[model samples]
Target: MGDTPTTIWPLDDARPGEVVVIARWSPSAGKSETIAALLPELIQQSRAESGCLGYQAYRPDGADNGDLVLVERYADQSALDAHRNSVHFRTLVLERIVPLLADRHAVVTTVQ
Candidate 1:
């Protein structure tokens, strides 16, 4: 399959051929184990989506405890929207995982 390009309004800095989402999550007090347990399933299901080009979760070496970084690539804006509205995203991320997080930050970008 080939890459699909996308554009974001206003700022308009995104390049063509895929949208990338970078997110950081910090688990709430004593909720680290729970968040970790949810990662594998989340990653697996997300990667299985047709619009998802890639889905990966990371923990920085020497970084603060219970911090997770997720890097995801999708075909385009529609693909990303579909992912955000997907059943797995709603259930596993918004409901199960988000409730255990102290904070979460995400940014959308594209290849230069």
Candidate 2:
């Protein structure tokens, strides 16, 4: 029997795959639901974008509502940037959705 050699891919090799963005949007008093209502369109439009791996919007269950959390995954930096510059993002999210928020925070990272 012949022996086979093992192959190892570097950790950084996986980094070229995608970028993840985690964000929280806390709308002003009485506006969370309004913003929440708009999320479906935002998510749908974003999903239709090129290089969009995953995009989601989440809100508190029941009456303990607080902030809206959005988790987004893109194929790379260029894809993420494209999403940000898209008409949907520019109009729906940046112009309309953002104004409803009292606070917003996000973190972006590269992922496999």
Candidate 3:
């Protein structure tokens, strides 16, 4: 499969045919480890999705942290939506991660 060009929204500025999603997560007090253990599988699954160009998970640099930042890119809106509605999203993200999270925020942007 051909790779789609990817760029950081704040840097390269997004363009059409690209969809960017930024997700910030704050795991519940004392639950960072639990959440951390689960993210690898989730990230792997997400990166394997069709139209996915990039999927990265980040946390604070210095120490074991309670926060996570997810940066994702898809070929288009439909791909992002498909990801949102995927079973993993419903079961793992919504059911599991959502409860462990103290708060979560997501923002979507289109490059163009």
Per-model CA lDDT versus the true structure: 0.81, 0.77, 0.80
Candidate 2 Cα misplacement greater than 4 A, ranges: 1-16, 60-63
Cα TM-score per model? 0.83, 0.80, 0.82
List clash counts for every candidate, in order: 1, 0, 5
Q: How far out, in Å, is residue 88 in model 1?
A: 0.5
User: Candidate 1, TM-score vs. the true structure?
Assistant: 0.83
The reply for model 1, stretches above 4 Å from the true place, is 1-15
The CA lDDT at 1 in model 3 is: 15
Candidate 2 lDDT tens digits, 1-112: 0013353322223456689888888888888777877788888899899888778666534535568767788888999999999999999988998898889999988874
Ranking by TM-score: 1, 3, 2
RMSD, one per candidate, in order: 7.8, 10.9, 5.3
Q: After superposition, how far is residue 57 of candidate 1 from its true place, in Å?
A: 0.6
Residue 59 local lDDT, model 1 = 75
Query: How big is the positional error of residue 74 in model 1, measured in Å on the Cα after superposition?
Result: 0.3
Please give the TM-score that candidate 3 achieves against the real structure: 0.82
Q: Model 1, 36: alpha-carbon shift in Å?
A: 0.7
Q: Model 1, 30: alpha-carbon shift in Å?
A: 0.8
